[model samples]
Target: MDMVNPIVLFVCFIVLSGPVLIVAGIIDMSKGSGTRGGILTVLGASTMGLVYWAYSAISHMNFSKGRVLRLKGRARVARRALGDGWADDATPDIEGLTPWQRTVLGEAWLYSAGMEHASVPAFAKLSLKLSAMGAPSELLEACHLAALDEVRHARRCFALARAYSGLPWSAGMIPELSQDRPQRPSPAEGDDWSRLVRGSLLDGCLGEGLAASVAAEVSRRASDPVIRETLAVIAEDEGRHAELAWDVIAFALERGGGTAKQALRQALDALETQRSPSLPSIPGVDEAFLARNGVLPQAELGRLMEECIQRTRARASSS
Candidate 1:
């Protein structure tokens, strides 16, 4: 059986429960409950309904309705006998792409694939750190799954690159996973918690949050069917990844006290200072063509970046 759409389920919950809550709140007030309690209940119900409506409208505007694309095949990372680190070696045969299109697609896919590979080590580090801190099993499991997701992302991106370029693409040497990895001091016996908090804030919350926002914007504007579908899938996964980051942060804060909170605030401020106005534009790339192919134009990218920064700052301040 096909799964129910989460968006539909959430909307139904809001619509059905909202009125019931409001009416019950009103009746409670009439039956002599305290004014403040009743007012809070009614206000909460109204807020939920309004928020759901607004979110639904915005999502509709940004995401086009289409049948879900089923992804097939598998891509795996293979170690080069003469080189260090793992790379995806699978190359599928594809036809009909022009040289220019091939170049654009190849570069784009390679960039994304490389980032996905990089994420593997990053997530692995996070999982180990969380494990050291005795984090709950669920969070640990999510971190492990996230690493696996990055593997899948790298494979899919490599496949796309190969298809477009009509040549094999390999994930080049990644230093992080190399056998000659740089030696670093272990996390101080008691400092693991602090390190975890900082890493989650910088990598998970800020980095993944920005990634998800950009991916969603690109998917929304993409004209190519393959590009749109692939990016949509990536955006959905990135959104969940970002949420997991925040969840980890919350978990840390619950036990981390004021020190953790202060560290997170400092991290946010530092990230804001390091922010760029937009994603860098590829030289010699046609803006119109990039837009058509799911690449965001510099102007739109800048606008979206600004919006994401503002939202992030707002959340930080409120927290």
Candidate 2:
């Protein structure tokens, strides 16, 4: 939060990435994207071996997993984005790139598009959760803005995917995201405070903290100027999102007393899961090419994830 405390805001951003990838894979399978689906399924499951060693009550509103609709052939819809500011519709130059190269980048961006698109609804749901709890206007407003940021993010990623893949596709519908959404905490539910605490800790702090770090790192290393800038923007916004989670967790702890504190303490055990990278290597992808295009290898990203966890531990100890 604004001040240092026993609980730190720095948590694993990619801590839940394994599960997300697995969920994405399942969705991919449903969409008949066997190549990505199979890969995501296997890697996601294995990554969970590193994760899911603990951290029960992982679903604070089921974490809002989103689905991407893979449309049939060249039918693209017109996109009305949040606004035309910065890289709203920017695409990387593919002047010297091969078709296969484009396909690889496209696939990577497509997956990223799904993740970003899902976040749009996730933030909207978070705002609902805050409103039911009667949170501050600032928090509520931030959620709305974050949702807009995600919308822009999804748009750009989809555009990049379209450019690289040479496909006329955009984001698909996500009815289930709203349908199975977590309801606001009714008075009868009673444990709303705990839910808020854990949700912010795991999802907001850890998740976005790791996200900000990874995006920044990827942006820094990426050879493509447009990709670098796009990630830089995402990195900055995700950093703010991480801070919002910190503020939310801090506020909950202050108000919810032992229940909230206890929730936070329990989620802290997630730090112990910090060990080696769990994901297997991609079979046909060239590591250097992917890196140049802004896609870091799974193992390297894992290392960055572990580093974030370690940094959190150090900061917690010093604080």
Which candidate has the top score in lDDT? 2
| Candidate 2 Cα RMSD (Å) | 14.8
Q: Which TM-score value belongs to model 1?
A: 0.65
- Which parts of model 1 have CA positions greater than 4 angstroms off? 1-97, 172-175, 178-190, 277-284
- For all candidates, the clash counts are 0, 4
lDDT of 1 by residue, 1-319 (tens): 9886443454345456667677777778778886855885777687565645443322222221111111111122233122223334444333554454555555466556656765776677677767877789999899888878777776677666655644456666543244433245354312545655666665666667767777788877777767777777777777778778888888888878887787777767766664544333343446776676656666775676677667766776666
Highest TM-score, which number? 2
Candidate 1 has its poorest 10 consecutive residues by lDDT at: 64-73
TM, every model: 0.65, 0.68
**lDDT per residue (tens digit) for residues 46-131 in model 2:** 76654343222111111111211212211122242222231346778888875445655665676566667777767776788788
Model 2 error, position 121 (Å): 1.2
C-alpha-based local distance difference test score of model 1: 0.61
Look at candidate 1 and tell me the lDDT of residue 13: 56
The per-model lDDT (C-alpha) reads 0.61, 0.64
